[model samples]
Target: EGLEELSKHCFDYAVIDEVHHAQAPSYRKVLARLNASFVLGLTATPERTDGVDAVALFDDILAWQATIGDGINEGSLVPFHYVGLKDDVDFQQIPWRNGHFDIAVLEQRVENSARMAKLWMAWRMHFGSRTIVFCCSQRHALFTRNWLRDRGVKAAAVFAGTGSDPRGESLRALVSGKLDAICAVDLFNEGVDLPDVDRVVMLRPTESKIVFLQQLGRGLRAAENKSRLIIIDFIGTPAIRTSDHSSPLIARRRMQ
Candidate 1:
């Protein structure tokens, strides 16, 4: 009965924002009782953080596959830079969660501080005119934005929770280059296209192949002098060799 209130009057379509958070007690109950005739579910961070279940409980499924090499070999996307940040840097000691970097601890140790400012400034000098930086936390993203803006680089920042109106506004600014740089956490990974983006900075490191692939994809859209995509890998990435990086990352590297 309470769920029906959401369906009052006429509604053509419905979209459930983040199914990853579906298990929240109240949300689980609401989603369990949903009676919508047509519904679409969406999420990026889908797996359970607790390890209870690795798969989503959706009623239907479809899948697609594309390789990083295929995209670049075909001239559809740009190449990547396989970089590793300083090993003994105080920033590298941040916490980790599963295959992802823990944002809270990383923010405290590295993201929103003087050390991070220096790192980003170096990158800004290297890729001055066109670039998109993939960041770790919301605070990290915004801090990079303000720091670069203060330095007169025309930078911007956005996150998953920025709401609809502002999301569109900020995105437009980035694509049009009215905003020279946009720092973000998880939103700019896939299903979003920014062809003019010539460079990418991975200020955060992730152990997941899917994540590295998605982040690299953002700059793969073909463009002018889009000759190479820049990736700054700060962590040691012990088991993962630079040559064995995301297919996009591997495919992007100049065969030397």
Candidate 2:
């Protein structure tokens, strides 16, 4: 209804934020109907996992590109200290197809008690005022949150279907220091500003570079007294394959 109302009139300018998602069917439909004199698309991530070129939608015009290193150098984002810990999970045993692992199998492989204990130990060793744990699924997130809470840590889980009220409250609590950590799925991956997060814990293996960067960017936002972001990444042997070297994190690991 909103789109229909807006479509009745032509606009002089149209701006689409998070334009990386413009390749989706809904976004494409809106773009096809938008009668704008000029359009501008903005996004931190231009790469798409579906092999579609988002930039080509803008008539192949190149505008600007900036990397994480650029943001850190310019003081817009804090530098990061990354620690890659070995994960005993055998990812090769999980089914991989179409550039992604079978999520159900992946979740089963990661959501075990021993793995959770290892994650808790890592977080305890490098504790921070605020932290976000990226999980493979809602079940994984809930399990992690429960595990943290049982240990007397103020934690909450947020994912899709966790309604706006509770999600908002949880985010507010984290920002206000009432909550120490949030175990989340892809809910915090993009379009969320969490400047106060000083630490990021990755419990799931990231297959896409875009996702890896987005997750890393969650804690990179500059905040008062935040000198640097600490990343505790659990990695399976297959995660560091040669194809993964294109990621900045992997590049940094190679240098180290």
Best by lDDT: 2
For candidate 2, the clash count comes to: 0
Question: What value does the lDDT take at residue 202 in candidate 2?
Answer: 85
TM-score of each: 0.63, 0.88
- What are the clashing pairs of model 1? 79-252, 80-252
| Worst lDDT 10-window in candidate 2 | 247-256
For model 2, the superposed segments whose C-alpha errors exceed 4 Å read 97-99, 162-165, 240-256
User: Against the correct fold, how does model 1 do in TM-score?
Assistant: 0.63
Clashing pairs in 2: none
> Candidate 1 at residue 234, lDDT?
58
lDDT string for model 2 (1-256, tens) is 8778778989999999999899999999898789999899998778787878799999988677777777787999888877677788999899987777888898888888887777777778776899999988888888788888999999999988753227889999999999999988888889899999999998889887678778888999999999988888887866542223224533344111
* Candidate 1 off by > 4 Å: 1-66, 87-102, 112-114, 162-165, 237-256
Q: Measured by TM-score, how close is model 2 to the native structure?
A: 0.88
